[model samples]
Every structure is written in C-alpha cells, then in structure tokens.
Target: MQAHAVIDHITGWLKDYHATAHSKGFVVGVSGGVDSAVVSILAARTGLPTLLLEMPIRQKEDQRERALAHIEDLKQRFPNVKAISVDLTPSFNTFAETVEVDESEYPAKQLALANARSRLRMMTLYYYGQLNGFLVTGTGNKVEDFGVGFFTKYGDGGVDISPIGDLLKTQVYELAAELEVIESIQKAQPTDGLWDTDRTDEQQMGATYPELEWAMSVHGWNRPEDFEGRQREVLEIYTRLNQAMQHKINPIPVCEIPLKLLNGS
Candidate 1:
C-alpha cells in the first residue's frame, strides 16, 4: 500500500467533498481506536475546521484517556482542530431505564443496550455536525465495515461519509503508523467499546482481524475442506458472520409498486 499516496488522495478527497457539499468542516467521533485516530488526522490534514468529540458513555478508563490524549495531540498539532468532551452516562442511563426489560431476557436486553450506546453516540456526532455545518465522518475500516459487517447498523454505521471504509484492518494500522498516530492507540487492542465488559473485537467475533481478512479474500472460492484446523475454524467463523450480517452489509430493501396497480381504474 502506497501509504503516502493514499494519505494524499484521502486528504484531497476530504477537502473536495467538503467544498462540494458546501459544508464548513468535518466532525468525527474519537474513540481512542486506530481507525478513528487515522480519520481524525486525515480530516485535520485538510486544514479545515475539524471537531473531535469524545462522547463517553461509561467508557473504559484507558480508552477514555487515549481519546483525550489523541484529541489534545491533534489540537496542539493543528490550529483548526477543536475538541469537545461530552459525558453521556446520564443520558444512557435514562434511556436504559425507560426501556428496561425483564431479567428473563437479560442476554438479549444487554445486546440491545450495547447497540443503543452506539446509536446515542451517532446522534451526538450529528448534533455537532449539523450545528457547525460539518460532515459527520465515520471511523469504520474496511474489514469491520464491509468484510464482516461488524459495525452496528444505523448506529456506528450512521454517518455522512466513511473515509476509511475502503481500507482493511491491517491497512488501517499501516496508515495510522504513517500518519504518526499515538503509539498507545496504534498498539491497543481493537474493540467496539460498546459493552461494559472488556471484550475485544476478536473475542466477540471469535477470530482476529488478520484471520477474518484472509477468509474474506478467499471465501468465494475457498472451501473449508481445503484447509485444516485453525484455518478451517476461521473460515467457518468468517463465513457465518459474513452471511448473518448481510442485512447490515446490503442496502435496505424497498418495495416497488406496479405502475398498472397504481393506475387501476
């Protein structure tokens, strides 16, 4: 991957898009993850007003610290970069209380609430974006956004534009290194940061990003029988997720009415 060229292209694309949309700047949710770090820097590189929001809903201490550090680093490096720290714990708690479910369905309820956290952040990002006439930028990388469909629909998936959606997980790290992203975030484990428990993306997905990447590349033609042990296991994991997440991966379905039915006498 031509890291420097890719950076230039993405930075140029951002500026052009901003001009085309007639927007003032970009707004990104900084989660202390490599993908978000890379995106924030890229947006900052455009020399346009960029707002980095740290909306924490009971976020982990390390994660929150990393986000704060990155935001501060960018603010120091770029004059146009601004930072906002919004604590959404109270908002999330209220919403959770309003939608409380029975203990019998605790497992399902937990998943729903986790996803709600993401949706709340999405709303917060848009609030700032609209307030400042800036585009809401997504931090999802290709592997999570497209390959496995690991992101939450209409939640983390809700954004005006996904600048790094075309790059794989490993490639995102490459870009992060090239862009001089903070060492802590670059070396930290990749996570969705949606659950209360310290669960990394690999733990939830049952496979590492590298394993999933290989499976995604060859799943169309490769069969489990051709591989052995871990390879077969990873392939199965990837295939199952890729199939189960099709709804998130594909465009929303719309029903089309027949012209004759509409014009019926």
Candidate 2:
C-alpha cells in the first residue's frame, strides 16, 4: 500500500503539526506491539526527539523483553530516540490493595484494575510529553479505535495525536513490514497488554481484527439475504460492541431536566 509514501505522509504530518502547535516532538508508549512500533518509527522520521517509555504493570517477562528489544532497535535506527523504563507493579499493587472491595459480592473490580493500568501509563506519557514539549502519540489502529472501541477512555485513548488511527489492521502490517518492526512483535498475538492474565485482543473483542474490519465495511450494517455463519456472527459482535460503548464513543452526556422537574423548571 505504498508504505514509504504512507510513512512519509505521517512523518510530514507530525513535523507540521508539531511546528504549528509549538511542540518539541513525540512521546510514545512502546508496548512492543506492531502499532506502537510503526508509530514510533514515523515519529522518529520527523527528525525530532522521540521519547519511548515502557511502563509495565504486572507485565509478562516476554512482553517486557520484547519492549526493551524494540526500544533498542529504535535507538539504533533513530538517533533522536531515547527510552525510559518504569515498572508500575508496585504502584498498582498499592492502589489495588487500597481499593479492593469484596470480590465475592462486588466482583467487577478486576476490570477496573485493568483500566487503571492503562490510565497510569497515560499519566506517565502525558507527564513526559508535557515536560519535554512533546505530543503523546497513540498506537490504536482504525478498527480498534473506531469500529470496536477497544481502548480505555482516558487510558490508551488518552493521547494528543493518533497517527495510525486511520489505517486498518491489515494496512498496519504493510507499514510494519516497510519499517522493519521487530519480527517477534510483528508476529506476537495482538493484546492490549492490560490484563493480569495476558488476554489477547481477540478474546476481549469477541472477534479478530480482520473480522471486525469486515463488519465495519459491510453494507451499512445490513444483514444480506445470504451470509456465512461467521459473517453473521461478526455483524452481531460489531453491533453489540457499538451498543455497549456508546458512552465511550459519545463521552459527554447532555444535561436535561428530569421528567419530574421539567414542569416546575
């Protein structure tokens, strides 16, 4: 998909955007995933400083190693790239203990904990970005960001700019190949890297990225007369995701007078 041209376009966009905003460069959270890797490279190509931060909270060893490996690779390729590692396990443990309610009765706190991890990472990125006058570059692709709402509201979604948000999942791979992303990260299962259990994105989304893309591309969300079983399933999954994430998609709720107060007001 003309990877070089696409990369050049994104890099140029970053350069212009940074200058217009009077910012120094980009600050990216490198999770050793393909999306982040590609975004980091694009940021590096701008000839501006790029800070790659690895904030792992109860992270798996392999994930941590891959993250460091990718950071080193970026440093070698981009002279302006500097990396910093901060393990958030201790902080997360403290917060979890401080807020853990009865799991037997209030059993949904684990999900909140996962979301907290993302928010913590966001706080770090924003702090560094603001300190150095850099923008926090988000790694979410199109299907995840728009189609499926596969990001925490103020967590992974909390970024100053999103370079790859327009690209589809398959398009990201094409760009990744051109950018020479780490082989392991490119091949690794796609995960949000949020949960303590290491759950993949497919598991959390109830469908693969490609499947979600297909649903998004379908004819106006219409169920055709003839459809394969999995195709229909994708439609259902996509619809359900959209229904459940309306709050995230449309975050600011309108304030209206209640029915009882409307007449008096």
Candidate 3:
C-alpha cells in the first residue's frame, strides 16, 4: 500500500469528519499496540484537540510503559494533543466481586469478564469524549473488524469513526513505520490486553494475521477442499470464527410488525 497516501487520506478524512460532526476533537484509547499507535498519530495529524486515554485495568508493565512513552511523544510533537492515564483496576475488581456465577460456568465467566474490561475502557473513553466534545475514535483494523470479527461488540467496537478500519494488519504496521510510531510499540506482539496473561492475538485466535488475511481474501471464492495441510487448518479457523461472530459483524436484528396487524385487519 502507498503508506504516505493512505496516511494523508486518513488525516484529511478525520479533519473533515470532525468538522461535519461539529465536535471539539478526537478521543482515542491508546493500548500501546500497533493499531492504536497508528490511529492516535493519525488523529494527532489532524491538529485537532486529540485526547489519548491510557485506561489500564491490571495492565502489564511493558504495555503500560509503551503506552506512556507514546503519549509523551505525541504531547511533545503536537500541541493539541493531551494524554491521561486512568487506572481501572480497582473498578474492575469491584465489578468482579459484585457479579455471581456458578463453578460449572467458569469458562463463560472468564470470557465475560475479559469482555467487560473492554466495555469499561469504552465507557471511560466516552466519558471523556462527552466531557470534551471529542468523538470516540476507533483503532480496529480490517482483519479484526471485518475479516474474523475479533472485536467485542459494543465494547472496543464502540466508536464515532474508525480511521484505520480499512487497513489490514500488515498495512497497519506499514503505516506505523511510515508514521514513525515508537519502536517499542511497533516491536511488541499484537494483543487485545483484555486478559491477565499476555497472550498474543495469534495465540488466542489460532492463526496469524497474514494467514487470516489470506483466508479472508478467498473465503467465498475458494473452499477448504482446494487446500492442504496447514492451509486447510487456517481456512477452517477463519471460517469458523467468521461464522460465529456474525452477530458482531452484521447489524442488530429488529422484529418489524406486519402491516396487517398494525392496521387491525
């Protein structure tokens, strides 16, 4: 991809969108991942009042350091940029304490809590967004947002505009390099940081972004029978996830009343 062109296009698009929305600026949750790093820079490039939020809930040290470093870097480079760190660990603990679950439902409870972490961050971002008239800028990429539906519904998926949602994971790294994103973040493994353990996205998803990208490309046009070995495995993983996450990928279902019923026919 033409990195420079894409960056310029996104920056301009953000500026135009902000003006149209009549909002004060952009608000982004910086997670020290490549996706968020690229997006925060793009938002800063617009020269609007961009707020970078570092809301950590039991975050790892390395991740926290990288996030702070990126925030400082942006503050130094852009006068319109403001950074804040809100520790949500206590809040999360309290929430966990209040919720009750059976031992048999351990797996579901763990997954629910993980998703709740994302939702907590989302709520924090919007809290500041409303306070500052800033739009909640999303940092999701094409692969996560559309390919496999890897994001949490109404959680990290909540946002006013997704500046980098069109770019693939590889393209996101390309843009990160072009934008001079901090070396630490660019080098770190891609993670959602929702769980306590530092599990990389690949480990959790059972497929690398590049592998998933290939599957996404030929999902409809090709079938698993056409491939062999690991190719088939990756395709199956992609297909299964895509099918399971349709609720997140598609619009919410709404039941419409029949016209005859409404007319009392």
Model 3 regions more than 4 Å off: none
Clashing pairs in 3: none
Reference-based lDDT, each prediction: 0.93, 0.89, 0.94
Return whichever of 2 and 3 wins on TM-score.
3
Give per-residue CA lDDT, model 1, range 63-115, as digits (tens): 99999999999999999999999999999999999988895967688889989
Model 2 CA RMSD to the hidden true structure, in angstroms: 2.8
Index of the highest-TM-score prediction = 3
Residue ranges of candidate 1 with Cα displaced over 4 Å: none
| Model 3 lDDT tens row, 1-265 | 8999999999999999999999999999999899999999999999989999999999998999999999999999999999989999999999999996885957698889999999999999999999999999999999999989989988999999999999899999999999999999989999999999878999999999999999999998988888999999999999999999889978788999999999999
Candidate 1: global Cα-lDDT? 0.93
- Model 2 weakest lDDT span, ten residues long: 219-228
Backbone clashes (count) for model 1 = 0
Q: After aligning candidate 3 to the native by TM-score, how far in Å is the CA of 205 from where it should be?
A: 0.4
